[model samples]
Target: MKKITVLAGDGIGPEIMASAIAVLQATASNYEQNFQFNNQLFGGAGIEASGRALPEATLQACYDADAILLGAIGGAIGSPWEKAKQTPEQGLLALRKALNLFANIRPICVPDALLPLSPVKEAIVKGTDFIVVRELTSGIYFGEPRQLQETKAYDTCRYTETEIARIAHKAFQLAQTRRKKVTSVDKANVLATSKLWRKVVTDVAKDYPDCTLEHQLVDSCAMRIVQQPTDFDVIVTENLFGDILSDEASVLPGTLGVLPSASHSENGVSLYEPIHGSAPDIAGKNCANPASMILSAALMLRQSFQEEKMAQSIEDAVFAVMNEGVVTPDLGGNAKTDEFTAAVIKKMQS
Candidate 1:
């Protein structure tokens, strides 16, 4: 049995988590796979349980699991978590640090049925199926030698050749499984870190000579993503630029409620979750969309377990269900979360 540590976080998290789990169970039965679901509290629930967003026991379970499925994290302002020594978000950062999670993958695939709802034109985003591989553990986000003061405030942006190379290799390897093209986005013309990023990535590209590599200025690359969404296959960049670019790319999918993300470490363990936040106001409403969480579970199967057929089955069921006008409130449909989940499972089982 594949051990999956499940973190049903705050707000709409638990509800969507239930949906994802139901879909996963259905997929397991259909594929004849055994998944051991390990439930754990997180975010605000964790705070309530042990005054911490990631309890000791929860982290241990995650360490021992095959892959992790997380719904979402964080709590609303004025919650007790805000008053804690470490906020719920801090726990996430700590977990990332502890696990040595160095890569963040966000695939911005626009379904054909949702192109009309996307900000990009149907002509542009109709076939958009690209993934962003963002370096999570290094670069500006974790760089130090900085200070914040009344007059002088500065944060250093740094990167090592190894940091740039490993993430580049990851993108290239992913591209080998996709369209075999990688657009390395950077401000190499201006930033010192990006100069090294470009240099190191260019060197790494030689290792995978079968994959095509092109360096794009972050500015023009951002513009191109909007102008020509399909021109991209895989995008690799440092932390700060990628954080912005991935969020920018997320718009191609229409609603954030349908986007899934994964964070990978050197270890085989990875964590999958939706890119959307905790809709605290909608907690327990039974109207929150669960497609993103369910798709995230599919990503877990594909990325962590290499269960391509099972993963694609879940993804196809989601696309089919959505195209049938069966989405939840986030997609402008009135169907309850369970209704949408049931539709996906029914589609999967059939």
Candidate 2:
């Protein structure tokens, strides 16, 4: 049996998680697969229940599981936790660190039906399919000596050759399977860290002689993503740039509600979650879109379980439902969250 740690975090987390789980259960049942799902509290739920955002029990549960499914985290922008010494996001960061989930992968694909919904013109977004392999554990977010003072507060952006090589290898391997092209995005002209990034990635590329490599400044990469998104196949970047660019690329699919993310370590342990955060306003309303969460489960099936057929089944079901206009409020449809999820499950079962 495949073990999964289910963390239904905060806000609309429970709602979307319930939907995603329903679909996951359906997939397992139909495919004669066994999934042992262990539910654990995390994020704001953890704080409220035990005064800790990532309780020890929760961490232990995740450690024992083969994979993790996260709904969402955080609460309202100016809520109590935001002002507290410990915030909901700390739990997520801590979880990633403890799990050693150094590689974050986000796929961006624009469906034909949602072409009109994207901010970019249909011509640019059409046939746009690329995956961003982000170096998650290091870079500015985790760099040491970050300090705040009266006037000269500063944060460091640092990376090692080892960090750059691993993620670059991952990106290249992924590219070899797809378009045989990997675009390494960095500000090599300015940032010293980015210069090291470019150098290490170039060295890694030599090993993957079958894969083509190109270097682009993060600024131009950002512009090209909107202008000619289809030109990219696989993009590998550092943490801060990936964090920003993934969110930007997600919109090309028409909504952030449709984007899922997977963070993995060198080992098999990985965490899956929708890119969109917890929507406190829609908590318990049954109006939030569950597509991203459902898709995250699809990612887990493919990456962790190695059940490519089951993963494709989930993806096809999602696409079928969306094509039929069976979506929640965020997708400009009247169907409730559960209703939309039910449609996807039905499609998968059929």
Name the candidate that leads on TM-score.
2
The number of the candidate with the highest lDDT is: 2
Candidate 1 stretches with Cα past 4 Å from truth are 77-79, 146-154
Ten-residue segment with the worst summed lDDT in candidate 1? 84-93
Q: In candidate 1, residue 29 scores what lDDT?
A: 68
Model 2 lDDT tens row, 268-325: 5899998889988788889988989999999999999898999999988888888888
Q: Over 4 Å off in model 2, which ranges?
A: 150-152
Clashing residue pairs, candidate 1? none
- Of candidate 2, the 10-residue stretch with the lowest lDDT total is 79-88
What TM-score does model 2 achieve against the real structure?
Answer: 0.96
Query: Residue-wise lDDT of candidate 1 within 177-280, one digit each (tens)?
Result: 99999999999899999999989999999999889999999999998988898999999988888878877887787677898889999866899988788888
Report the number of backbone clashes for model 1.
Answer: 0
